[model samples]
Target: MLNYEGIAASKGYAIANAYKLVHPNLSFSTMKIGNPSKQVKRLNNAIKRAVNDLNKIEEVVITNMGSASSEIFKLQATFISSPNFINEVSSVIIDSKVNAETAVSEILERRISKLKNAGNGKFVLDKIKDIDDIRKRLLAYLLNKNMSDLALIQSPVIVVSEDLTPNDIIQLSNKNVKGVIADLGTNTSHSAILTKSLNIPSIFGLNNISKNVSNDDLIIVNGMSGEVIVNPSNELVKEYSLKITKYNQTEKPLDKLKKRNAFTKDGKKIGINANISSPKEVNLIKNYMIDGIGLYRTEYLYIDSYSLPTEDEQFNVYKNILSSMNNKPVVIRTLDIGGDKQVPYLDNNDSSERNPFLGNRSIRFSLSKTIIFRTQIRALLRASIYGNLSIMFPMISELNEWYKVKKIINEEKRKLDDGGIAYKNPKLGIMVEVPSVAIMADQFAKNVDFMSIGTNDLIQYVMAADRGNPTVAALDNPLNPALLRMLERVVNVANAYKMDISLCGEMACNRYALPILIGMGFKNLSMNINSTLDVKALLSLLDYSLMQKMSEEIIKNACTVKDVIKIEQRFIKI
Candidate 1:
């Protein structure tokens, strides 16, 4: 067994033979070119065939994945077919009238040129990520354009690769894909995000797993632990299989907790909320028995498009989510973009930071460009009419900054009324992530309808830990006494102000933190969809009075994080 660790991008268990996908050792410069006319015709046929193959794959996904999953694939195909993408390629092929390989290269070069001209250099680079594919497509066009390199792999296989693009990952869905391990990928990589969404087990940054493991060797991939056991003896497989069975059995009890309201023994109701980005995730609301969506990340509406989404486009998305949840409150966070996410229309001039999380990003970047913020505020306000919508500003700290957003909201409302546009004035809230905001939660609670503690950032800010940096990840603990003190203060303020408060970050999803949250009088916990039931179960099992006492002891005694963890374990049954 060779063990490696990485953040589990998705969830599941798989035992399969390693099916390594080695990158072609060959380079573009070494490939041979044939007769131009034959190559052109061959390349066109190959494109046609590849398109047809993709279409068939889509149909298979539609049947297997049903309506919900199929929409994602269809949207991806639409992206490929967009005028900005397809037209550029077609025009290049026609205008150049060269061999298919040359035509594809010319098209790519022209697109790169256009991107350079546009001045958003990042946008063009993000589009054509598969450098090897470009080379092969060109080579095939020149030599035998009609040739198709697509091959169907037999399954119960562990897919090993140098890296995977979003398009490549999408195409693998509903096929007998068992597991995926890659040589390279970051947490925010498109491939990682998509794989997580698909619920497939994956491990990336494996440096050389493919070279060591042979095809058809029985291997167990523990995604949760990031361990791979190759050629495990039968006895070892059975032992691990039993362990997995026991874990699954433990999970079965959680299902019974789904419909039960998450309240402690003292009858305190803790609201279990969810975080969602798309309409497709709305189904999670009912399935997970969540109180509402605590955070509705709106960046996806802008990231996937060539241009800024029209007010109507944004309106449709917000309205769809609102209507789908049947009036459950959704805290629609205004665009939180920085680091890897860059909107073309927005003048995001923040340089890549040595520590991107702590640097200029989120609300700071949005406020720098007021026009973008105002447009989004207007759209969100208009959508509020359809359901229980609340606006939460990200990275807010100073009082002046809070009011700055409020001023824009007020102005947008006035403009809407002036233009006879329909909208509802939803309550606004702020995310308490920066240490400044956490310290001033009392004053902030007095102004806003609610305060959501974004622990992911708060810990990053408080510990001065950059979560993106692997070396510092161990230090990113929300259970730290410093953070617990902040949460206590935030909750106490919310109680004083007669306002609601919740946490909507990675911490909310963790079962161990539920006792502490409820103990601190935080009745609302928002997290990813799958974690709702798990947290609910943990909440149901604990005595609220004991948790409260335990929480107070930690805050009052000023213990370290380890001490708090020990105290929590001693009290909570989990």
Candidate 2:
């Protein structure tokens, strides 16, 4: 048996025969170009067709996965339609006197080389793969070469590829594809996001696994531990089979707790809510017996459409989700755009920035575009009358930004009042994502009605590490002493002022972190809908008093994530 380690993108296990997908080499000798204008027209037509294909793919992806994952295809569609990329190809064709395919290949290669040599971080370097995928599709269309048809695979098998794009994952979803093992991709890649949503076992960044495994070799993909076993012995296969059986048996009982309230042994009732992206996820809320919607990401309404969603459109979506929740409190976060998530229509002049995460995004972007910001605020205020609703602003680092946002919201309300429109005043809040806001939580708590700790960005910004980059994923841990201290401070401020505080990050979903969070006095936790039952069941079994004592010790003694893990293990054993 050969064992290889990779980055675990999804959690599961799969044993199946390998099916390799190799890209055919499309090499053509330089042909004497007859008419440059004709070649340019052909290239433009091919680009149009590629854009249409991407749009269709985007619709399918949005239906299968959420809009957040579908952003990958939307981005590709925008990149192909960009003026810079199109102009580069046209210039190369006219100047080099080569065919459209040759011109595209040459320009893409040059652009890829330039980007790689720029020495940007891994987040920027990953875009190279996206550009390359676009090149492959455009070239295939121009040359009339057949692309890989994943639907043709009739039998179940694990897909092994050098690199798989979002388009590839969508195509493979229709087949009997059991799992995926790729040579290149990070846990935050589009391919990884799709597999996680589809509940497929997947491992990526395995470095040339396609070259080692034969076409029909028996393979075991252990996505939980990021291990891929090739040609495993019969004994090892039997061992894994028993392990899978045990896991299924344990998971079956957790489903029974879906309808139960999550309360500690001491009778402290904890609110278990879900973080949703779109209205379609409301069905999961009812199915999981969630308390409410803690974080309703509004960026999808802006990102997925060709233009901004009208106030009526946005109001209908928010109203439907609130009505579905039966008056449960739904916290709707304003549009968190810019940074990695960009909308082509929102910004006309697109330019690459050295550091986008720290740049225009979240509240800053919304505030800059007051007209757009007001429309969403109006819709949110209008929707408040439907059911329980709360409005929250993201990425509020300073007190001034919060004031600016409040000013606009108040203005929108005044407009509604002057027009004799009926609306309710929902609770207002700010996300404590930036370290500055966490440090000044006492002052912020005095102004806002509530605070939701966004641990995902808090850990990333606190540690100065990019969460989406695999190289720095290890440092982006919430258990880090600095991050915990920040959270502690925020919680203390919230308690002193009698303000409502909840943690709405991926950390809340972690089994080990749950005790510390509850111990830190967080009464509300929001996570994915699929995790609500398991987390609720786990919370009910723990003693709140003991967890609080242990968490205090952990915060005082633990300095590193490793130290925190050791402390958590000791408590678990008790």
Candidate 3:
């Protein structure tokens, strides 16, 4: 038996035969085109067909995987129709006199090479897979060749691939595929996102997995532990089978706590809400027994569309989500696009910064394009009549940004009023993600109706470490004493002003962080849909008074994350 370790993306255990998916290398002879005009025409036709194919796939993905995952197809379709991409391919064919397939392959390779040479780092490296997927699909259409489809798998298998694109994962939905193991990918990759949404156990970043694993080899994919055992012994198989059964049994108890409130033994009720990207996810509220939505990521709407969504279109999506919530407070964050999450349609000249994270992003990007910002504000204002809605601005580092955003929102309200549009001004809030903002939390809390600490970015910026970078992942610790002190300050400011505050980052949902957060006086907590039930169950078993004492000791005595964790373990033992 051979054991391999990788990064665990989704949670589950699966034992099945391995099905190797090796992409065939296409060999083509370069031939001068007899007629450039005809070649260009053929290229255009191929692109059109690819766009049409992607559109069909988009609908299927939306129905099966939700709008967030469906965005991958929409993005690919946009790239296919992009004038820059089309013109580049046409130029290659006309200038080099090469066939459509060769021209596309050459141009895509050149573009990918340029992206790498520019030192764009991991973000651009991940995008290379998407471009490669497009190249394969287009070339297949031009070559009149058939590409392997996961939907055609005849039996249950653990899919082994060099890299599974978003489209590949989507096609595996409802198929006999039980798990996924890939040679290259990260937790933030699109393939990982799709697998999690589809509930398929997955592991990534296993180097040379495709070379070592053969077809029909019995494999055990332990996604929770990031372990892959190839041709396991009977003893190991039996052990894993028992572990799977126990894991499932443990999870079943969480369902019983779904109807129960998240209250400590001493009777302190903490609101447990969800963080969602689309309206389709609102259906999970009842199933998870969520109090409300803590964070409604509005960036996906912008990133997924070919153009900016019209006010009415945006209004309808927000209204549907709010109405479905049935009076539960839904905090709608305005378009947080920029930095790593860029939209081609919204691209301006200022996007070529060396460090996009510190450059124009979130509120800075929105304020620069007031027209786009106002349109979203108008939509949220129109949707406010449906349920309890709150507006939040991301990446607010100073007071002026908040004042400017509020001014524009008021201006949008006046425009609506003049047009006789019925709307209400929802509660306004700002995300305390920057250290500068956390330092001024007291002043900012008094101005905004509420505050939500985005611990993900907060820790990243506070520690000067990029969370996505593996080398610095350890530095971006939420349990770090410095981070704890920052949160302590923000919470104290919010409490001092009696403003409602909630922590809406990954930390809020983490079981280990729950006692510290509740002890710090965070009455509202929000996390991913899957974590809600377990967190609620954990909360029910804790005593708030004891957590408060531990929290005090943690903030006062602990000078490092390890010390804080040690304190938490001691409290848990009690």
Global lDDT of each candidate: 0.69, 0.80, 0.81
Models ranked on TM-score: 1, 3, 2
- For residue 480, model 2's alpha carbon misses the true position, in angstroms, by 1.3
Off by over 4 Å in 2: 17-177, 180-197, 204-219, 230-235, 348-351
**Which is superior by lDDT, 1 or 3?**
3
Per residue, candidate 2 scores C-alpha lDDT tens digits across 1-574 of 8998988877778888998987766776776596889999989998998888777766755665557446666788888889998999999889888899998888888867766565322224225556777889888888877555454466879899988754566566543778899987655554675576566888987888999998889999998889999999999899888877886788789888888889987799999988876677787568777789999889867655534678898989988887888899999999987555666556522266667788888898888888788989999998889899999999999999988988998999999999988899999999998999998888998899999998877888898987556566678666787788789889989999999999987788667888889999999998767667678877877889988888898899998888888988877652
**In terms of TM-score, how similar is model 3 to the real structure?**
0.81
Highest-scoring model, TM-score? 1
**Best lDDT among the predictions, by candidate number:** 3
* TM-score result, candidate 1: 0.83
Model 3 clash count equals 0
Cα TM-score per model: 0.83, 0.77, 0.81
lDDT of 3 by residue, 519-551 (tens): 988999877777777787788778999999989
- From the highest lDDT down, the ranking of the candidates is 3, 2, 1
Q: lDDT tens string, model 1, 1-574?
A: 5566655555556777777665443224323344445544555565555455546656765554445434443444444445665455555455555445555666666654665466432343333323334445445544533332212454557776667744456455655677787766533344555665565677765666668776677777676666667778888789778766776788688788777777766677888887765566776467666688898888866654545666787888899888988898889999887754555445443464665565568888778868778878888988999999999999887888888888888989999999999988798999988889878888887778888888877877888866444455557676788888888887888888889788877777566666788788887888767667667766767888898898888788756878888887777667
